[model samples]
Target: MAGVIVDTRGLARSEQNGRGSAEPEAALPDSDRPELGGALEALSGEILKKRSLEISSTSFVTIISIILGVALALLAEKTFPFPRPLVAAQSACMLLLFVCTFYYFLSISIILRWAPSFADCAQPFIITSLEIPPTYFLGRVTGWDACLAILFVFVAAGVGSTVMWSPVSHFGGDRKAQRMLHRIFREVAVIFGTGALSLASIGLAAHFAQAGKMWWGFGSCAVVLATLGALVARMEIQLSRIHAYYGVNRPPFN
Candidate 1:
């Protein structure tokens, strides 16, 4: 039964248009909105640097995952007809994914601790366009619990994806790179964390009851891992686009 109305910057632009200003917000210079973190061009430069450092940290997880996978394959070959080694390899992979997911969850929690809640605040989800009445009384409208469970699962998957490819460690922990990468990760973490919070408050899917909840629980776990693999692929594409924007050059882009 947790929810909020969304009626801030998400709709502020539309309000300006209705007044026949021809979207002046877009035309206004970056200096006009100091609250928006200033100039887009400068922001892009910083974004590039931060994302590069993130990519390097992300690379560590990628390299380690690949090496582990290859080693398992070779071990399986050596074991040949032995089922135990194959089973062990599978278990290890699962353990690695789970550990990474758990770490990602921890990182998110750290951000949430400092980030303000979007629920029951001035920044609620506006629903005037949907005719649902932003001020409608929506207390415990049944099935809310199930919706929350599903949302937690999805958020888990989303955050897990962020870290499945990027493990945080000291491999590239030079003084400046470390500080910059941490800052970049912090920003990404906050955005992702806020999103997760908003979704969790609103909830997802349908209601599950009795023994069915157990089945849904297992399914959610599988979804988290699968989502991580899929997101990693998408992350590569995103990194390529960012690199192209910043001018693709040598690795360790400073």
Candidate 2:
């Protein structure tokens, strides 16, 4: 999506060469009102807050997915291993699900790493801003954090691929080749992630069969899937509103 990145650098250059020194807001031409700077800064802050919430919500969903997913896998493995075909299917789905979650967090984290730059981009616009150091990472930078994060993403993808074998084989190539696939991670996660839930639901039903209560475990999974569906719907609505607000027309590839 083409967002309205307030080119503060360009705007500052224009303000400097075109209009000589700082003066009262009222003194500037209507086209170059100082108040607009503050307004844009405020909007940027609001957008960042919204993005942070999106990150948190997605993280929470992934956590719940992993926990319930693990439980479902264990239940199925103990009760319905070997000859059952679902053992193979559940294992594959879980692997892909992990891959999607890894990429999802990595995408958000990389975007957040640029937040300090974004804060600097907001600086001059604020009338009474604090002198912030240019090195903010939302909090602090722990030693080995970057290394651990990179390792985490790759490890998840590696294990997931090992399980699924030919899963996502279409997107295997250099970075440039995978650009189109990268853009649609959210869509993939929602669609295939739903598929993952279905596998888990079936596995749950199979597990409860050993106890002669085949449908009991499915009830819990159904609730979990419903909650996840609601979360995805909310995220889609948020994206649609953001695109509408920014007049951003994302091409199919992007």
lDDT of each: 0.39, 0.39
**Candidate 2 segments exceeding 4 Å error:** 1-111, 114-213, 250-254
1-254 per-residue lDDT for model 1 (tens digits): 25876669958887877877655677788877456554555557768767655554444345444544554455445344544432334333334444444344333332222212332121111111111111121222123223323433444444334443333343233344333334444444444344334434333331324335433333433443454454344434444443444466423212
lDDT of 2 by residue, 1-254 (tens): 47767779998898897766656778878888655336544457878867665665455445545544554455345434353333343233334334444444443333222223443333222201111110111111221122222323333333233223212442343343233333334343454345434444544454445553323323333433453354345434544443444466533214
User: How many clashing residue pairs, candidate 1?
Assistant: 6
Candidate 1 lDDT at 195 equals: 37
TM-score per candidate, chains pooled: 0.25, 0.26
Tell me the lDDT of candidate 1.
Answer: 0.39
- For candidate 2, the per-residue lDDT at 199 reads 40
